[model samples]
Structure formats: C-alpha cells, structure tokens
Target chain A: MSTIIDGLSLGSIYALIALGYTMVYGIAKMLNFAHGDIIMIGAYALFTMMNLTGSPIVAIITAIVVCTLLGIVIEKVAYKPLRGASPLAVLITAIGVSYLLQSVAQIIYGAKARPVTLFSLGTVKFGEVTLSLSALVTLIVCAVIMVGLTLFVKCTKIGRAMVAVSEDKAAAQLMGVNVNNIISITFAIGSCLAAFAAVFYLLQISATSPTLGSMPGIKAFTAAVIGGIGSIPGAMIGGILLGLIEKLCQSVTALSPYTTAIEFGILILILLVKPTGLLGRKRREKV
Target chain B: MSYMLETNNLGISFGGLKAVQDVNLKIEKNCLYGLIGPNGAGKTTLFNMLTGVYKPTTGSFSLDGENLTGLSQETINHKGIARTFQNIRLFNNMSVIRNVLVGLHNQPDFKCNPFVSMIHAKRHYENESNMRNRAKELLRIFDLEEERNNLACNLPYGKQRKLEIARALATNPKLLLLDEPAAGMNPQETAELMDTIRFIRDEFDLTVLLIEHDMSLVSGICDEITVLNFGTVLDHGSTRSVLANPEVIKAYLGD
Candidate 1:
C-alpha cells in the first residue's frame, strides 16, 4: 500500500511533465528535446524565489511564469526559423537548445545540488495506510490539473483550434486560426505544466541542481512514448504505469538494481510490438 | 468598376519554370465564377496565390478594394475568405460537429479566458453552448447532424464533401473557394453537388470561385467562366460563350 501511494505521487509528477512532451509533439510535431531542461530552469527559479520570499505559492507562480516565457522565447528564436525544415534539422536544433540551457544554468549555479526546504503541507491517512503530506498534495494537484486541462481542451474555443491545427495546419489556417499564436500558446502551456511538475517533483526529492531535471525528464519522455507520444491521456496512463512498475520492481530485491534497464527494456519490447505506441495513431500519408 | 476580388498580373515561378504567368481576374460581388483549365494549368496554383498559400512572384490582389496581396492565409481568412481543399482536408480524427466547431471558433467573442474556463464559469458555459448550438445548426443544414458524433474519416465521401463545405460556411465567409469539390463524385453526386452549390450561394449570399473539370456542371451552374490553357487565360465570358469558344474546346480536347 505504501509503495502504491509512492508510485501514485511519483507517477502524477511524471504525468504532469509528460503532458508537456506529448502536447508539444502533438501540436507542433516537434520533439522539443529542450522540454526537460525547462524543468531544471523552473526548479532554479522556484528555489531562488522561495529562498527570497519564503512563500511556496509565490515561488511556484514565478517559476511557472519564467518557464512559460522561456518556452515561448526558445520557440520564437530557435524553432520558428526552422519551420517546415527536415525532422533531423529540427531535432539537431532542439538538442542544441537543450545543451545551451544546461550550459547557461551550469555557469550561473555551478554543478552542486541546491537543497530545498520541504514543507509538510499535511498528510492523509486511510485506515492502516498513511501517505506523506507532500505526496497527497501532489496527487490532489495533479488530479485538479488533469481534470481542468481535459475540460479546457474539450470545452474551450482555443482548445478546439489547437485540435484543428494539430490535425491540418493549412486547413486550420484557412479556418482563420492564427497558427503561430497557437504554436506559441502550446509551448507556453507545456512549459507552465513543466514548472508545476517541478514544484511537486522537487518537493518529493528536496533537491535542485543544474542536472536535476535530466533523469525525470527522460523518464517522462519514456512515459510519453510508452503511452503514445501524441495522445494526451496516453501520457498520463503511461506515466502512472511506469511509476507503479518501477516502484514494484524496487520492492522486489532481485529486480531493484536493474529497474532502469528493465524499464527501458520494456520500452524496446513495446516499440517492437507497436511502432506507433499503444495509443498512437498511424500516420497516414496523402498521395 | 469595383470588384469583390480583383487580381492583376498574378504570376509565380519555381526556379526557371514559370508555372503561372500574367493572370488577371475581376470577380464581381456574389458571382458564381468558374475557373476551368486542363490539368497542370495552374488553376490550383492561382487558388493557392489567392488564398495566400503561395506568394506570387509579381502581382497584387484586392478584396473589396482592400489589398490582400501579401497577407497570410489566416489574415485572408479573417478578411472573410474561406476555402475547401482539392483532396478534402477535413480533420479526419475529429468528429463532424467538432470540425465545424473549429471553424466557428475564430469569433472574437469566443476568445479564451483561461481563468474563467478553468473554473467552468457561467460565461464559459454560455459561450460553449452557443458555439455548440451554432455548430449543430450548421451540421443540420449539411444533413450531417445525425453523424455529428462520428469521426470525419468515417463519413461517406459525398457526405465528407458536404461536411467540408459546411465547415467552410461556419467561418461565415464572404467569398467561398472550392477546389475540385466534385472531383471524385459520381454523376448523381455531381448533379446533387451542382444544386447544393447553387443553393449555398443563394442562401449564404456570397461570392464563389471554383476550379473544376466537369464541363457540364460548369456550364450548367456557373453564371460566368474563365478558361485557362498552359496557365494563361484562353477566354473569359458568360459560361455559354466560353464553353463554345474554339480555343476553350481545343484546350479541353486536342484538335
């Protein structure tokens, strides 16, 4: 039961972050390799703000704003120029942007891990099971965000425009959707989610570093692929499943050491079975 | 005299090949004008230019005396021009109703207020229900209300074509551009489409420009027609006269 609670909290964090990856890929059709780095940037921003203000909410909001702005800036400066370019070229540019962000952070904060003062928001107990305060809070936040996001995507006009743009950019343009604005908005939303994920994520780990986002970022991306890269719900499902599997593996002494390898091995097996991933739509080419 | 849409010396080149050159058009308001040409005659290219999908190497166009020469597609759309594609580029994965909703979404009134919407505020629900009502009304007109929940890809081809036009109408366009709308339809469907086009024009009170290969449909439906061969206008006049012209006949059928 403890492992399940741990898995749910960790999985929600991954799910939140994976949503960024899936949304960027879905709408812009770019890998956005720098998405992970945004988490690190958010962490640093939150840490600095929290240290100065001693308010978690203010820090989280500031971090989210910073990440959103950075995401938009990076998209305008780096990705916009390469629109309609080859996937390889875009991929290379994304990797470059990722490195550039890491280098900038390294120069500013150095390589040492920064400690974050974790606050016990409150714990939840159900019968014999007791979950950490942070974990319960993280789960609640994730639930609210997920429900809100789903509603936003389904009920809002801009959200419908996003769907149209993702389906057929030219057609969407003909419908008077400002494709550039939509693209910028996609990045902003993704980055904002990343920042929110960072707050909950670092809460669990209680540390922030230049490289803090790397492991979780890769795992979330793996979650995205496992669920079906372009499907929003898929990312959430994949993240939770991955977290549960990893936690379960850790509980078993025999499999604990090889958890990462085992997780990746599952990815390989999944790819071999379904190239488009579980919920991924088969890309149809019009002749 | 003023025109709803006017183009002069509209031309484009790809490397050394002049795909379309020295094209001129003066489309009157609310006119059902047909643009007919042989395959590769740059009919679609002209549509692309007019819609801002491709920028002309040399030329300018105006809609209601407002210059639209260098505007983006979205801007052109905002300027009240909407179009359907040659290959029918409906959002296939989206439901029929959702497809129309996307078109209805561009209204300034429907602009997102994330904070209100996130909380499912009264205003958000009001705007959403209004948009839904409007989209459903459009579907009803296209006889697609019954299939509102079905994926666009699952719709029959004829229904898909109608849905495309229906979606275009949701944009509330002043000018409608239909590219090869009747291309794959059978004789019955083509005849039905001819009536539908006429009905839409009369009901919507809009100007229309269409590219088509069906001579009978063009002659039967269009008030005026322009004939093109090798990207240059061969003739332009009333549909009856253009179709009867020697050059237009030769363009369609070799001498």
Candidate 2:
C-alpha cells in the first residue's frame, strides 16, 4: 500500500512533464527536445526566486512566468523560422537547443547539484499507509491540471482553434485562425506546465542541477510514447504505470539497479505490439 | 459602382513560369460568379491569390473597396473572405459542430478570455452556448445536424462538401470561394448542390466565386462567368454569352 502511494506520487510528476511533451508534439508537430531543459531552467529560476524572496508561492509564480517567456522566445527565434523545413532538420535544431540550454545553465550554476528547499507541508498517516504531504499535493495538482486541460481543449474557442490548427494549418488559416499565434500559445502552456512539474519534481528529489532535467525528461518522454505520444489521458496512464513499475522494482532489492532497463524493455515491447502507442489513433493519409 | 471583389491586373510568376498573369476581375455584390477553365488554366491559382494564399507578384485586389493585397490569409479571412479547398479539408478529427465552431473562433461577438474559459465562468458559458447554438444552426441548414457530434472525416463525400461550405459560412464571410465544390458528386447531388449554392447566396446575402469543371452545374446557377486558358482570361461576361463564346469553347474542347 505504501509502495503504491509512492508510485502514484512519482508517476504524477512524470505525467505533468509528459503532458507538456504531448501537447507541443500534438499542436506544433515537433518534438521539442529542449522541453526537458525548460524544466531545469524553471528549477533554477525557482531556486533563485526563493532565495531572493524566501516565499514558495512567489518563487513558483516567477518561475512560471520566466519559463513561459523562455518557451515563447525559443519558439519564435528557433522553431518559427524552421516551420516548413524537413522534420529531420527540426529535430536537429531541437537537439541543438537542448545542448545550448544545458551549456548556459552550466555557465551560471556550475556542474554541482544544488539542494532545493521544499515546502514543509508535513506528512499524512492513514493507519499502515503513510503519505508525504508533498506526494498527496502532487497527486491532487496533477489530477486537477489534467481535468482542466481536457475541459479547456474540449469546451473553449481558443481550444477548438488549437485542434483545428493541428489538423490542417491552411484550413485553420482560412477559418481566420492565426497559426503562428496558436503555436506560441501552445509553447507557453507547455512551458507553464513544465514550471509546475519542476516544483513537484524538486520537492520529491530535493535537488537541482543542469543535467537533472535530462533524466526525468527522457523518462517522461518515454511515458508519453508509452501512453500514445499525442494523447492526454494516455500520458497520465503511462506515467503512473511507469512510476508504479519503478517503485515496485525499487521495493525489491534485486531489481533496483535494473529498473531503467526494465522500463525501456517494456517500451520496446509496447512499440512492437502497438506502434502508435496506447491511445494514439492511426492516421490515414488520403492519396 | 463598387464591386464585392476586384482584382486589378493581378498576376503571379514562379521564376519564368507565369502561372497567372494580367487577370483583372470584377465580381458584383450578391453575384454568383463562375471561373471555368481547363486544368492548369490557373483557376485554382487565381482563387489562391484572391484568398491571399499566394502573394501576387503584380497588381492588387480589394474587398468591398478595401485593398487586401499582400495581407495574410487569416487577415483576409477576418476581412470577410473565406474559402473551401478543391480537396475537402475539414478538421477531420473534430466533431462536425466543432468544425463550424472553429470558423466562429475569430468572431468578436463570441470572444472570451482564455482564463475565463479555464474557470468555466458565466461569461464563458454564455459565449460558448451562443457559439454552439450558432454552429448548430449552420449544421441544421446544411442538413448535417444529425451528424453534428460525429468526426468530420466520417461524413459521406457529398455531406462533407456541404459541411465545408457550412464551416466557411460560420466565419460570416462576405465573399465565399468554392473550388470545384461538386467535383465528385453524382448528378442528383450536383443538382442539389446547385440549389443549395443559390439558396445560400440569397439566404446569406453573400457574393460567391467558384471554380468548376461541371458545365451544366456552372451554367445552371452562375449569373456570370470567366473563362481562362493558359494563365490568361479568354472571356468574361454573363454565363450564357461566355459559355457560348467560340474562344471559351476552343479553350475547353481544344482546336
């Protein structure tokens, strides 16, 4: 029971990150490889803001604003110009951006990992099952965000525009949708989610580093692929399942070191069985 | 007299290839105008230029006396020009109603802040319901109300074409461009479509420009016609005279 709770908490963080990945990929049709690095940048911003203001809420808000701006800038400067370029070229540029962000972080923060000051929300005990306050909070926040995002996409005009843009850019334009503005909005929302994920992620690990985002970033991406790359619910399911599996493996002493391998092995197996991922619909190209 | 759409010496060239050149067109308000041509006669290319899909290498065009040349496609759409592609390009994954709602997105009356939408505020709810009602009305007119919740890609071919027009109408366009709307329809469907086209022009008070290969449908509905051959206008006049022109017949049937 304790292990399951732990898994759920960890999975919630992965799900948050995966949501960003899936959304950008869905709307922009680009794998924003630097997305994980944005989480790192968010963590750094949070660390700096917390030190300056000594308030967790202020720090989180500042980090979100900063990361949102950064996401938009990165898109306008990097991705916008490459809109019609081949997918391979875009992928390479994304990789370049990831490295640039990491290098910039290293120049400012150095190579050492910095400990994050977590909010002392305290823990909860339900008989034999004990849940950390942060874990409980993470789960609630993740669920709320997921539901809110789903509703936003399903119910709102701007949300409908996003869906239309993703389906066909030219058609969306004819309907009076500014495709570039929509793409920027997608980046903003994805980066804002990354900032929130950074907070919970730091709370769980209690540490921050330039390279820290890379591991979790890759893991979250894996979760996205497992769930179906562009699906909202799929990301949640994949993240939680991955977290549970990892937690269960950690609970067994013998499988502790091999957990990463096992997770990837599962990813390979899932791909072989269902290349489009769990919730992904197969697209039929009209000839 | 001010025209609904006027292109003055409009043309575009790709390197040395003059795709569309020196095409001056005048379409009256509430007029049903037809653009008929052989394949590669640049009918679609002309439509593309009118909708701002391609920047004209020469000349200018205007909508209701407002110059719209060099503007972006979305801007042109916002200025009351909307179009459907030669190939049906509905938002395939979205529900039929949602496709119309997308066209309604830029309407100032339906605008709600993103934050308000997120919270499902009263303003957002009202705006949403209004847009939904409007979209439903459009779907109802197009006889697509029964399939309002179905994905657009799942709709039958003829219905899909109607939905595209419905979606375009949802934008509240003053000038509607239909590119070969009856391309794949049966005789019955094409006849029905012709009636729908005429009905919509009268009902919506819209000016329409369409490209078509179907002579019977074009002559059956279009009030005026322009025939193009080899990137230039061969004839422009009322439908009967234009269709009867020896030059137009030569363009269509060859020498």
Candidate 3:
C-alpha cells in the first residue's frame, strides 16, 4: 500500500514532465531534446524565487512563467527556421540547445547542489499508511493539470488546430490555422507542465543542481515512449506503470541495484516489439 | 467588369527548367473554370502557384484586385481561397466532424481558454456546440452527415474525396480549388460528383478552378476550359471550342 502511494507521487511528476515531450512531438514532429533541461531551469527559477520571497506560490508561478517564455523563445529562434529542413538538422539543434542550457547553468550556478526547503501544508494518514503532505499535493496537482490538458486538447479550437497541423501542416495552413502560433503554444504548455514537475520533484528530494533534470527528464521521455510518444493518456499510464515497476523492483533486495538497467531493457524491448509504442498510430503515406 | 481572379505572365522554374511559363488567365465571378493537360504539362503546378504553394518566379496574380503574389498559403486562404490536394489529405486519425471543425479555425473563439476549457466552462461548451453545428451543416451539404463520427481514414475513397471538399468548404472560401478531385472515382461516382460540384458552386456562390483528366467531366461542367502543353497554354476557350481545337487533341495524342 505504501509502495503504491510512493509510486503514485513519483509517477505524477514523471507524467507531468512526459506530457511536455508528448505534446511537442505530436505537433512539431520533432523531439525537443532540450525539454528535459527546461525542468532544470524551472528548478533553479524556483530556487531563486523561493529564496527571494520565501513563498511557494510565488516560486511556482515564477518557474512556470520563465520556462514557458524560454520554451517559446527557443522554438521561435532555433526551431522555427528549420520547419522545412530535414528532421536530422532539427534534432541536432535540439541537442545543441540542451547542451547550451547545461553550459549556461554551469556558468551561473557552479557545480554544487543547492539545498531547498519545500513547502508543506500538512499530512494525511489513512489507517496504517502515512504519506507526506507534499506527496498528496503533488498527486492532486498532477491530476488537475492532466485533466485540464486533456480538455484543452480535446475541446478547444487551437487544440484542434494542433492536431490538424500534426496530421498535415500544409493542409492545416490551407484551413487558415496559424501553424507557427500553434507550435509556440504547444511548447509553452509543455514547459508549464515541466515547471510544475520540477517543483514536485524538488519537494521530494529537497535539492536542486545543474544536472538535476537529466535523470528525471530521460525517465519521463522513456515513459512517453513506453506509453506512445504522441499519446497524452499513454504518457500518464506509462509513467504510473514505470513508477510502480521501479518501486516494486526496489522493494526486492536483489533486484534493487539493477532497476535502471531493467527499465532501459524494457524500453528497448518495447521498441523492438512495437515501434509505435502502445497507442501510437503508424503513419500511412498516401501517394 | 473586372475578373474575379486574374493572372498575367505567371510562371515558375526549377534551375533552367521552366516548369510553367507565360500563362495568362482571367476567371469571372462564380465561374467554373477547368484546366486540363497531359501529365507533367504543369496543371497541378499551376494550381500550386495560384494557391501560394509556390510563388511564381516571374509574374503575378490577383483576387478581387488584391495581389496574391508572394503570400503564404494560409494567408492566401485567409483571403478567401481554399483548396484540396490531388491526393486526399484528410486528418486521418480525427473524426469527420473534427476535420471540418479544423477548417473553421478562423471563426471567432467560440469557447476556449486553457483554464476555462479544463473546467468545462459554460462559454467553452457553447462555443463547441456552435462549432459542431457548423461542422454538421457542412457535412450535410457534402452528404457526409451520417459519417460525422467516423475516422477520416475509415471512409471509402469517394466519400473521402467528398469529405475533403466538405472540409475545404468549411473555411467559407470565396474561391475553391479542386485538384483531380475525381481522380480515383468510378463512372457512377464521377457522374454524381459532377452534379455535386455544380450544386455546391451555385449553393455556396463560389468561383471554382479544377484540374481534371476526365474529358467528359470537364466538358460537361466547365464554363471555360484551358489546355496546357509543355508548361504553356496551348488553347483556351469555351468547352466545345477548346475540345474541338486540333492542338488540344494533338496534345493529348502523340504526333
């Protein structure tokens, strides 16, 4: 029971971050390799604002706003011009952006980890199971955001335009959708999710560092692929399943040390078995 | 009276190859214009230029006196032009209704905000219902109302073509461009598509430019016909005159 609770908290964070990967991939058809680094930036933003204001809400808002703007700027400057270029060129650019963020962080924050005091309202216990207040808050926040995201994609006009652009950019353009604006919005939404994920993650570990986003970012990407890279629900399901599996593995004494390797093995196996991921539709080219 | 659409010396090239060149056209309001040519005679290329898929290399065109040269495809579309592909390009994963809704992107924000939509707010609900109603009306015009919920890929080829036009029409365009819309249809479907095209032209009060290889379809419906050979207009006139022109016949058949 405790393991399930713990896994839920961790999975919520992964799910939040993985949404960024899935949405950008769905609309833009290019992986934002720098997406993971946005979480690190979000963490630092939170760290600085928390120290300045000593308020959780202010810090969270600052992190979200900073990441959202950063995402839009990166997309406009780096990715926009490469819209018609080959996918390989765009991919290399994404990786370049990732390394650039890391280098910038190194210059500013240095190599040492910074300690952060997490905001805690209170804790809730349900008969023999005691979970931290932060864990409960993370789960609730993730749930609201996920539901909100689904609604945004499914019910809104711009959201429908995103799906149309993903399907056929030229066709969507012919329909009068501003493809660039939709792409920028997709990045912004994904970055906002990343900002939230970073906050919950910092709460769990109580520290921030230049490299802090790497492991979680990679894991979230793995979660996205496991669920199906372009699928929103798949990200959530894949993340929770991955969290459960990791927790279960850790519970077993002999397998605990191999959890990372085991998770990666599962990713490789899924790729081999189903290249489209769980719910991803295989593209059918029309001649 | 001014032409609804006009082009002068409109052409494009790739390196030294003049893919299309030295073409002049004048289409009157609410006219159904047909462009026919042998494969590689640049019929689709002409459509590409007019639709702003490719900017003309050396000339210009206008719609309602507005120069369309050098505009992006979407900007041109916003200027009251809409088109479908030679090959169908429906949003295959989406429902027929959703595809039509996408076509209506420019309509006022019926209901949406990330936060409001997430909460299923009243305004959002009203906007979606309005959009759905609009999409349904378009589907009805194309006789696709019954399949509104089906995935686009699941539709038969004839229906898919109709759905594509339906989606295009949802943009509320003043001019409609159809590139070989009946390319794959059977004789019966083609006959029905002809009637449907004529009906929609009148019903929607739209100017239509179409590229078709089917002589019977073109001659039966087109108000004016233009024939192209080797990137230049070979002959253009009333359907009967152009079809009777030896140059058009010779262009279709080898020397």
Candidate 4:
C-alpha cells in the first residue's frame, strides 16, 4: 500500500510534467528535448530566490515567473529559428539546449544539492496507508492543472488553434493562425508546466541540484511515449502506469536492485509490442 | 482603377529553370476567377507567388495597395488573403470542426489567461460555438457535416479536398485561393464542386481564385480564365475566348 501511494504521488508529478512533452509535441511535432532541463532551471530558480530572500512563497512565484520567461527565450533562440527542420536536427538542438542549461546552472549554482523547504512534512492516514501532506498537495495541484490544461485544449480558441496547427500547419496558416507564435506559445506553456512539475517534485523530495532534472525528465518522456506522445490523457495514464511499475519493481525483494532496469524494460516491452504506444494513433504525412 | 490583387512581371525560377515567369493578373473584387493550364504550366507556382510562398524573381505583388513583396505569409493572411494547397492539407489528427475553429484563433484578441479562456468568458464560448456552427454549416453544405467530429485523416479523398476549402473559408479572407478543387474528384464530383464554389463565393462574400484543369468546370463556372504555358501567360480572357484561342489549344492539347 505504501509503495503504491508513493509511486502514485511521484507518478502524478511525472504525468504533469509529461503533459508538457505531449502538449508541445502535439502542436509542434518536435520533441522539445530540453524540456527536462527546463524543470531543473525552475528548481534552481526557486532555490536561488529562496536563498536570496528566505521567503518561500516569493521564491515559488519568482521561480515560476523566471522559468516561464526562460522557456520563452529558449523557444525564441533555440527552437524557433530552427522551425521546420528535420526531427533529428530539432532533437539534437533540444539536447544541446539541455546541456547548455545544465552547464549554465552548474556554473551559477555551484554544482551542489540544496533542500527546498516545502511547508514541512505533514501526513494524513487513509486506512493503513499514510500520505504526506506534500505528496497530497502535489497530487491535488497536478490534478487541477491537468484539468485546466484539458479544458484549455478542449474549450479555448487558442487551444483549438494549437490543435489546428498540429493537424495541418498549411491549413492552419490558411486559417490565419500565426503558426510561429502558436509554436512559441506551445513551448512556453510546456516549459511552464515543466517548471511547475519541478516544484511539485521538489516539494515531495525537498532537494535541488543543477542535474536534478535529468532523471525526472527522462521518466516523464518515457511516460509520455508510453501513454501516447501526442495525447493529453495518454500522458496522464502512462505516467501513473510508469510510477506504479517503478514502485512495484522496487517493492519486490528480488527486483529492488533493478528498479531502473525495470523502468527501461517496460519501455522496451511497450515499444516492441506497439510502436506508437498503447493509446497512440497512427499519423500520416500530407505536407 | 483599383484591384483586389495585382502582380507585375512576377516570376520565379527553380535553379534557372523557370517555374513561373512574366505572369501578371488583376483580381477585381468579388469575382470568381480561374487560372487554368496544363498539369505543369506553373499554376501552383503562380498560386505560391500570390500567396507569398515563393518570392518572385523580378516582380511586385500587391494586396489592397500594400506592397506584399517582403511580407510574411502570416502577414499576408492577416491582411485577409488566404489560400489552400493542391495537396489536401488538413490537420489530419485534429477534429474537422476544430480544424475550422483554428481559423478564428488567428486573431489574438483573446486574453492570454488560460483561466478566462477556460471559464467565465461568455463571448469566447458564444463566438466559439458560433464558429463551430459555421464550420458545420460549411461541411454540411459540402456534405461533410456527419464527419465533423472525426479526425481529418478519415475523410474520403474528395471530401478532404472540400474540407480544405472549408477550412480555408474559416479564415475569413477577402480573397480565397483554391489550388485544385477537383484534383482527385470524378466528373460528377467536379460538376457538384462547380456549384459549391459558386455558392461559397456568394455566401461568404468572397472573391475567389482557383487553379484547375477541368475545362468543363472552368468554362462553365469561371468568369474568366488565364492560361499559362512554360511559366508565361499564353492567353487570358473570357473562358470561351481563351479556350477557343489556337495558342491555348495548341499548348494544352498540342497542334
């Protein structure tokens, strides 16, 4: 029970962050590979602001704002100019941006781990299982954001525009969609969500480092691909499944040493069984 | 006299191979114009130039007296000129109505707040539903209403072509450019499309320019026709006159 709850909490956060991946890919069809690093950047933003001001709320807001801006900048500088390039070019550029951010962060933050002071570790018990207040809060916040995101994509005009761009860029262009602006907005929103996910994860784990984003980022992308790369609901489901898998693997006495291996094994299994994903649909090229 | 669209000495060459050259045309307001020629007579290239896809080698194109030589395609589209490609390009994964809803999104008057857009904006909701209805109406008019919720990829080949035009009309352009409204359609489908084009023009109050090869549709529905051969205008006038011209006949059908 404890393992399930813990895995779910972490999985929820990964799912939230994976939305960033899936959403951006849904619109741009390019893997914003640097998206993982964006979460790291957000964590550091909170860390530096907290260190400077010692005010938790201020730190959170500052981190979110700065991360959002950084996301916009990354899109404008790194991704936007390379629009319409091959997936390989964009993917490599995303990796380059990830390295660039990691290096910049290491240089600035001194390459040491720091603890984030979330509102203290409190817990509530359900049946025999205990849930940390931070974990509970993370689940709640992620739920709210995911709900908002779902509605935004479903009910909003810009959201519809993003859908259109994803569907047929030329047709969207004919419809007067500023494809560039929409793509940039996609990155900004995805990055902002990644940052939010960083804060959520840090709240549960209470530590920060320049390289902290790497593992979580990979996990979230895996979740996204597992669920369905271009699907919103798929990301959520994939994330939960991945979290459960990770936890279930760790709980087994014989498999405890193979947690990472199990995570990878699931990915391999899913890919070999279904290339697109469990929920992923096939896409045909028109343009 | 003023024209809705004008291009002078407009031309483009693909590595010294002339794709379209010395092309000039004036689109008067609210006229349903047709550009017809053989399969490779640069009709698509000409459409590309007018819509700011390929830059002309040595000519100027203007929309509403605005110099469109350096403007981006988005800017040109924003200025109320929109186009569809010969290859049916719809957001394949997107729903049919959302594909059309994307047109109204080009205008960024909506507040960037996801909160407002998600809830409590009556105008946004109303306008959006209205837009959806409009798209539905278009699809229904084109006999695609039942497929509004389906992904664009599932549409039949002929319907996909019409959906592109419907999606294009969603942009609310003063001038609409259709690359080939009958690319993969049968003779019966092309005949129905001629009436559909006329209905779309009048209903939307749009000036239409189409690239087509179906001489029956062109001569029957086009107010005027321009023939291009080897990237140059071989003939231009009323459809009967141009089709009757020996130059057009020889270039298209051979001597």
* Top model number, lDDT: 2
Q: Ten consecutive residues with minimal summed lDDT in candidate 1 chain B?
A: B105-114
- Put down candidate 2 lDDT per residue, B1-255, tens digits, no spaces: 899999999999999999999999999999999999999999999989988889999999999999999999999999999999899999998999999999999998887898888889999999989999999999988899999999998999999999999999999999999999999999999999998999899999999999999998999999999988899999999999998888888888989
The candidate, 3 or 4, that scores higher on TM-score is 3
Q: TM-score, chain A, per candidate?
A: 0.96, 0.97, 0.97, 0.95
DockQ category of candidate 3: medium
| Model 4 per-residue lDDT tens digits across residues B7-124 | 8889888897989888888878878899988888899888877776677787888876777885667777888788887877777777777776676566544334556666748766
lDDT per residue as tens, model 1, A109-208: 8889998864656667889888787877788899889888887788787788888999999999988889999999999999999998889888888888
- Ten-residue stretch with the least lDDT total in model 4 chain A: A167-176
Among all windows of 10 consecutive residues in model 1 chain A, the one with the lowest summed lDDT is A116-125
lDDT of 3: 0.89
lDDT of each: 0.89, 0.92, 0.89, 0.82
Query: Which of the two candidates, 2 or 3, achieves a greater DockQ against the reference?
Result: 2
- Each candidate structure's count of clashing pairs: 0, 0, 0, 2
Task: Give residue B198's error in model 2 in angstroms.
Answer: 1.5
**Colliding residue pairs in candidate 3:** none
- What fraction of the native alpha-carbon contacts across the interface, defined at 8 angstroms, is recovered by model 4? 0.86
**What are the per-residue Cα lDDT tens digits for candidate 1 across B1-255?**
789989998899989989888888889998999999999999999999988999999988888889899899989988988999888999999999999999987877676586787777899889888888988988887788999999999999989999999999988888999998898899898998898888888888889999999877888789898887788888898999888888888888899
lDDT measured at residue A97 in model 3 versus the true structure, 0 to 100: 95
Greater-lDDT candidate between 2 and 3: 2
Computed on C-alphas against the true complex, the DockQ of each candidate is 0.83, 0.89, 0.75, 0.71
TM-score of each: 0.97, 0.98, 0.97, 0.94
> Which prediction has more favorable DockQ, 1 or 2?
2
DockQ of 4: 0.71
The DockQ assigned to candidate 1 is 0.83
Ranked candidates, highest lDDT first: 2, 3, 1, 4
lDDT of 4 by residue, A82-119 (tens): 88788899899999999999999889877888887755
